[model samples]
Target: MAGPGEFELIREYFSSRFQTGAQAGGVDSGVVLGIGDDCALLTPPRGKMLATSVDTLVADVHFPASADPYRIASRALRVNLSDLAGMNAEPLWFTLALTLPESNAAWLEPFARGLADTARLYGITLIGGDTTKGPLSITVQVTGSCDRALRRDGASAGDHIFVSNQLGAAAAALPIVLEEYEPSEVQQQQADAAFYFPEPQLELARSIGACASAGLDISDGLLADLAHICEASGLGADLKLDTFPIAELAQSMSADAALETALTGGDDYQLCFTVPAKYLDHLQGLQLPITAVGRMREARGIDCFLGGKPWQPRGTGYRHF
Candidate 1:
């Protein structure tokens, strides 16, 4: 059984499907040329800075290889979109670099639909990409624009730290996702949603961008990701462990374990940002799930205090190496 060739696969699955509506010949998607050309032409909005990020999710590494293709695509795109959100960037377009061991339509149909649907959901267009024969992996490079850029190097001592929504759900869901644990139906659903459809905090980032001193998405985990802001801004943080908003999915675990997971687990995709004291009232005015759990310090590393005493985690966070 011979599969479709490269060009045929592109036409059937990607090109024909994405080249519709405003994206048709770059009418409204800011594309001068999309797909089938040597390069993609795009127009960045005037007076706004361009922000771009790229991520590669390898099968069985970043995600379970046997997971649903649709969910995989959604997780892939959503996490990348989180990068834009952390920087308060508005997503404009993206390029996909898909490497597959073989071209299978059963996989391509839902995968392409997943990509297309997520793109539409985010109001981003697929401009161009490359397809190659290799191990299953998806690499997406997202480009966004920012009228006001929130960077990682702007934090200072006395700034407060916050995370959008809850944390540790995805890290807790890993056991269910890997079939190591069988949870109740509701827990299973929560697991799937947390791991497969992690929401990017774009609106929250935009809401606080004007006052947030520094920000980044919590892909690696709260402690590890916050360390990045510390390193970049040359300051440390002290987290109020008791005030931590542990996710319901993670709450099923033991109290100590859940808190540890919330602190050190990865894939939350929430925003961990620093805010000046001046904007605390402004942030409180918004009806969002922003939680202030820490404050930047004059020190050089993260400090965790629980019950007014120092606490430590078994591990800092997920490490690729």
Candidate 2:
């Protein structure tokens, strides 16, 4: 079906989907002002500091236009939230900058609904933004407040590395999107869910706040994201591929494909962090299902080992260049 023009699309598709009030569709849980306001106002609970992050999802670059608009909208916002979660922050407010070739009310409605649902879950309020005619792309900048912000460079040489949940599901979805292979029904569901509705691990971040010294959401896969921590801490990491929390879905793929996808492919969005040995018990006691995939080392190079063998990947993580 052909899409509708812009203004009608926004009004019909977007306007009703997001109601700006605590009582209205639960969007205003902590929001002071919502939707129609010139700007949104929000105050974090006392004593917390704020951290902000901006992420852009471009058409063709981030997702194919054929992708579901609702999923796209949710992902656009959640990915930004993932950044905040990595910092062990509480989501507070957000602003969106959206560009589209044309508007269709049908598309915008579900998109706004998806955004509202995810925002409500994170207690984030939408403030102000600009809508313009252009190529299809979305940019969301989110603000989160925390008692203490986690930094990427806080890892010490002796810290232990941990990752939340599993990896490589998003990368595995690429084959489905590219139609290179037909995924089994279960695999298709896993891949599509990974691509569309990724959880930002906010609960884990809140639970591990002060205990987490250095952390980042793994948008660029394990090898690449861990390298960021390694570079930031001025140290090295020896990642044990066998210890990586590879998902059951990923395991169904060929061993080589799974390894490459887990190591070099991007978009996993799980938290990779360091905890001091002293807090190891607290971390372990939490029983968060995190695995010690690697450890911080005194050396200054990033390395990975799989099956007791060196894992040398030809390419690093996702590089726009």
Candidate 3:
């Protein structure tokens, strides 16, 4: 018995499944040309600038090889969307470059379904991409449009740093996934859900575009990702430990362990951004669950403080090397 060939695999699993503007009730208006084209064609909305980002997920490195194909596919696409969210861009379309060890219909079927389901949910159409034989990996290029992009270098010294949601639940799930820790059933469910289905916070991003000066998604740990803004803006930050909207799963752990996970355990996928102090009232008016975790400062590095005293965390975040 032989595995399916590339074209056959695509026909059955990918090519025909991706929705078009016509199929989506003309919602995907920005997609000029989708799959089967030599190159995707996109038209940015009038007066809006295009925002593009690419992200790759490797087997075992980004997710466990034994993970469910549906969840993995969803995560791959969602993470790329998070990048656009950081720039306050509305997602338009995406391209996928998938490498597989071999063609297995059982695996590809659910994977494509997951990808299609997520794309439709966000009103993004699948454009074009490549398929090749290799180790399992997925690379997605997402294109979005915004009138003015939120950038890392825009934060000012007096701005207040905010995060969209609670942190460290995804990080806390790692120990359970590795069998290093046996959590209670409720705790396990909470952590696993956070790890597998992290939300991109697109609506929240759009609402803050005019108010936020600098921002990025918290794929890396909070401290590490915040450092990126500080480095780009030539400023520092002071994170109030007590102000962290720590996830309930992490809060269940020892204080030191929870803090460590919140600081260094990556994969949270929340938005971390800075708003000018003057706009704090405006930000509050949005009524989003945004938390003011810290303040940008004139210094050149990040400082953690607990009860007016400086505190140090164990690690920064995940590193590729």
**Number of the top-ranking candidate, with lDDT as the measure:** 1
Pick the winner on lDDT between candidates 2 and 3: 3
Q: Candidate 1's residue-wise lDDT over 56-127, tens digit each?
A: 999999898888999999999999999999889998899899888887888888899889889988888888
Clashes of each: 0, 3, 0
Q: Show the colliding residue pairs in model 3.
A: none
In model 2, the runs with Cα more than 4 Å from the true position are 1-15, 21-30, 314-321
Residue ranges of candidate 1 with Cα displaced over 4 Å: 1-7, 20-22, 25-28, 316-321
Ranking 1 against 3 by lDDT, winner:
1
Q: What value does the lDDT take at residue 248 in candidate 1?
A: 98
Candidates in descending lDDT order: 1, 3, 2
Full-model lDDT for every candidate: 0.86, 0.77, 0.82
In order of appearance, the predictions have TM-scores of: 0.94, 0.88, 0.93
Question: Would you give me the overall lDDT of model 1?
Answer: 0.86
lDDT by residue (tens digit), candidate 3, 155-203: 9998999998888888877766555677899987886678777888899
